[model samples]
Target: MNQRVLSGSDLAERARRAIPGGVNSGQRSIPGLTDLVITEADGARFRDADGREYVDYHAAFGPPLLGHNDPDVSAAVAEAGRTVDLCGVGVTTAEVELAEALVELVPSVEKVLLTSTGSEATFHALRVARAATGRRLVVKFQGCYHGWHDAVSLNVISAPERVGARDPISAGILPEVLEATLVLRFNDAEGVRAAFAEYGRDIAAVIVEPVPHNVGCLLPEREFLRTLRDECTRAGSVLIFDEVISGFRHDLGGWQAISGITPDLTTMGKAIANGYPVGALGGRADLMELFSSRPGGSVFFAGTYNGHPAVVAAALATLRKIRTEPVHEHVFRLGDRIRTGLSEVFAGLGLPAVVTGYGSVFVAYFMTGPARTYDDLLRNDASMFVGYRRRLLGHGVFELPLNLKRSHVSYAHTETDVDRLLEAAAAAARAQLADGDVLADVADASTMGGVADRC
Candidate 1:
């Protein structure tokens, strides 16, 4: 461990006694990062319990797009807290306004339902799909994570042995649930067409991440996204865009707005409320209508905090900022700056690396060039990737020191922030390339990507 990051060592030790693996989430427990307990996050930087300041590229796994503790969002939340409280009966004014904003912004959403987490949004979306179509099977792609529900939790971050196998990331998942999900490869248009051809009638929905951020980033080909949309439409099965990662981060209207391919349903979260606990499911009115509180309605929807007033206020404030400010433009420019900067640094060092990102997120795969699929990512130098990120952490840059995880830039980041991050990353790369022995010490947990298995 670096001597600079040791201030949190005492708190980390105490946390291990209280929480399993010393953190609340699997991603938080990523080896080197577990020791860091972030005490304050504001704008583009956060401070660990050690009182060490670092530019935040992790961004709480792709939230805080407007930056942590934005004054507007925080004020909105505070006002909502003072004015209103949860009733668990009918909708709040903030909820209705937020829904209307989502409908206006998101191309595919005619009606919207709010949930507390992306996982719940996806779960309810599938339930509605099944109820509307009376089908048992759902289709998802390899490495495209649509949250941790039984239906779509299979075949994400699969190891080499389980690439083509029925690789459920968790053990307690029901066999029937795994069997119902037909996992296909991302960008494999033929595979998608074939799945629809064979199981069209039985398929309830086909959910996909327009950009598969789970395995770093698999930029969807136009043909692949069109195929999923077309096949699902032809088969009369629902097409779901699980844009939990891509939703409000890439565009105000989401990736669907950028690609011009809309799905029957969409799941949104993470950047939607910029770090607030807000998740939404929305789509064609006819399909969304299937969920009801009435006894006869096929899909049931109930949540005590579905659209908590404060959460909706935060979301509304975030949407307001994106709609009015140059958020996407700034983030995209800085994202490009960092990506190009890292690529040039790696090039100058004569390292084999492929730099990739979409909009505000970026990744450095220490292996082949132009990776498009999980199979390609399997070739990345796991040791080198982990080691480089660990070195960056030591140099005051914070990315999860793990393989195939992407870093994000927020609206609060400035040109100077980008420049500093580039310098730290270049140093990390040079240090790793020069001293192979240094990499053997990036903590013991090397499991690639999964929920419970990361630490």
Candidate 2:
């Protein structure tokens, strides 16, 4: 028998026949940036199946905080493979150790529960809130994305027509579930107040992404977050900070540490495991005890793969490195470099754009002024956003071309990498802005048409 070496395009074609839209996640099916089959990832770069290398600012949508294939995390996972696999009945020691760390580090987490994905963490958090308070309503900001759960999978990156309306991002969700969720604008303190005034007693939780990273980083207004705390406290509604993206990426304590505002519950994932699949929900011990497995329990919370040994080991290693090493200091410096560099690039070219983000995350918006809400981001040129990102791929920088998406910086990146990105950005912006095409001239993505092998 002869071995078959498949091209990236050939693999993508094979996937399209099997997977919906040739991708597992909707965001991966980019119009001009799909078809890459990643063969390897290490440090700050990734290589496509065909061996084309690119500096990876995509960072697997902000999961690779320590950078792709971090040595510490990889080694831990390898060791775990030799030790334990899965025993669903009992919890793993690694899980207990991770929970202890979460409680110690995250300001609001007195106790914690492990899960396999961000979505599951969020779903469980909302359930806890509803069960604890006996309320039916959940208040979610428009631009923030907690997860794909029915209550949240709406209004994110919504079309202009759907703004300010109860628009479900997906159909088939029970109408009552949509009604239970009150959609409000990010940084809209008045909206929070009004919602509380109308349905305070019925609202179970006010879920937010302290920094709305999903729509390219709409930094939260301190007053708005404070207002949420005050309203939720007065109404006895649980305040849930969905820190899936901003959790371990920002600080060991999550954004709650830097913000100086505590939530009743916190959901964390993404960088917690340095790209390993693990999520955690943590909060006051009194509330977390509502899980079916606990004393005086009622709410059901179970996952067959929760706290799988290898991923738990990865999380433990990632946390230990964050505690002992200069991970945050390094990545923060690089984040500032990229954001400032991008700002300078656009300003020098006399282009109107806004660059915004907190530590280790940056988004270059193709519009004038700042973006603190979904409404402000709508002013951005969606076409130019996609086209500029597409052009950068030609320069060997991997940024997903989806509009309102942010680029990440990791400890693996260097000042030289920032310089290269700026140089690439200058060239891409000059050509893209001058041509003024509706992304018509953007370079083609990989030679394939389906899924990207992002490992």
Task: Find the candidate with the highest lDDT and give its number.
Answer: 1
**Per-residue lDDT of candidate 1, residues 1-455 (tens digit):** 66754468888889999998887776777755667788998999999887789888988888799999999999999999999999998778888899999999999999999999998998999999998999999888888887777887788877789898889877798898788888888999999988888889899999898998978888989999999888988999999998889999998889999999999999999998989998999999888877885446668899988999988999999999998999999999999988899999999999999999988999998887768878888888888888888888777888877677888999999999988898998898889888866666553355456642211
RMSD of 2: 3.0
Q: Give the TM-score of candidate 1.
A: 0.96
TM-score of 2: 0.95
Clash pairs (backbone) in predicted model 1: none
| Cα error, candidate 1, residue 343 (Å) | 1.1
Worst 10 residues of 1 by lDDT: 446-455
Give lDDT for model 1. Answer: 0.87
The parts of candidate 2 lying over 4 Å away from their true place are 1-4, 441-455
Q: For model 2, how does the per-residue alpha-carbon lDDT over 285-324 read when each residue is reduced to its tens digit?
A: 8999999868559999888888999989999999999899
Residue 305 error, candidate 1, Å:
0.8
Residue 42 miss distance in model 1 (angstroms): 0.8
